[model samples]
Target: MEKVNLVFGTVYGSAQFVAETLTSKIAELDFETNLIQSSDLTGFVPKEDELLIIVTSTTGQGDLPDDIAPWFAEMKSAAPYLPGLRYSIIGLGDSSYETFCGAAKQFDELFAELGAKPLTARLDIDACETMEPETDAVQWISTWHSAAQSLNQ
Candidate 1:
């Protein structure tokens, strides 16, 4: 009965917005879900049967938001083996930054090293672009839904 959980890390709040929208949309699509922020996680780990979707916004210099940095550092150091975890990430950032989406890239890599399986490719949504910020995320979720529905997470 493990549900899909949406974990977001935001500085200026764009990632939170995206996470909220995704939570609503995913619920509409009939999946049980939970939305959690970085500060909300303290000794949190997904059950072996759970799925996770991470949406994070890079802060200064493509750094992980201060709230989430410690968690990532801990995870990296601990290297928790989540062999049954399935996840995907949507990264928000401005393309102008030299390290655009660096945090997300790091997280994605780190998760793999921890033995989590990716449901789809990591998506980078550039706030600098003219398109709506959530457009790509929405589309990616739709595409992923069909594919993921057929598989066990």
Candidate 2:
């Protein structure tokens, strides 16, 4: 019965949609889900019973979305000290861009640096792909959920 936190760092709102879907799916699996933007992460840390899921998109020239800038910096510096922060990530970007899914990659690296264990591999989606966003998210979540079930043990 642990809480699941779905954090979004979105630019064009695509990432937000993915976060919402993730929240709903987690709820269906019987876990409490808190949907928040990455900006809200500053100074607020979840407890050990919480699971964090990040959905982020790379903005212009591979920058994080406006809201996540501050949190990103703090997390980068503080990650190594974080306690019991198990997490997963889904990054959206256009592979055609020079920095494909840069934001997602950054967060993944930060979480790893901070000692957070990933429930699943970071799922990276290319914007130019023919697959719909929802489909990609659903696929990733299905795999993630299976992996996450073992996390609370």
Candidate 3:
């Protein structure tokens, strides 16, 4: 079975809720899914066959959540090459903020810089537009799953 690493960072837990909601959906698609907190990962590198899904919510002044900042910084400092990795990002933020989904954008850029290929376009869920980000995120998983399966075929 293919594997999905669902890594998430949350401030008040919205992102974590979204990630947890997707886990069952991912399993329904027959992919083995692992739900991980961003802070829990250390010196992590993606395997070629693994799919990485990053779900993050921006915090104060468009910064990564406290739990994820150190991990992201470490990854940046390591700057490992990731040409074989395929991934996607789900960003949750308010459009009214100057840096809406800024953390996710930063992650996307960093992944691109490290040569990680995106499985699909990033999904940005605006707090101003929706009360339930998990709903939007859940809808996106099917599309992302299709893209992941396509690569294997």
Report the number of the highest-TM-score candidate: 3
Q: Model 1: per-residue lDDT, tens digit, 1-153?
A: 337899888887778888888888888887888998777787777666777988998988878987778888888887889988889899998899899998899899999999999978898999888356677788788876875686744
**Residue pairs with backbone atoms closer than 3 Å in model 1 (clashes):** none
Per-candidate TM-score against the hidden true structure: 0.91, 0.90, 0.96
- Candidate 2 per-residue lDDT over residues 1-153, each given as its tens digit: 778888888877888998998889879889889998665688766455688888898998888898777888876666546557778888999999999999999888888777777878889999799456757998777787777777756
lDDT scores in order: 0.83, 0.82, 0.90
Name model 1 segments beyond 4 Å from true. Answer: none
Q: For model 3, what is the error of residue 39's alpha carbon versus the real structure, in angstroms, after optimal superposition?
A: 4.3
Best by lDDT: 3
RMSD of each: 1.8, 1.8, 1.0
Sort by TM-score, top down from the best: 3, 1, 2
**Greater-TM-score candidate between 1 and 2:** 1
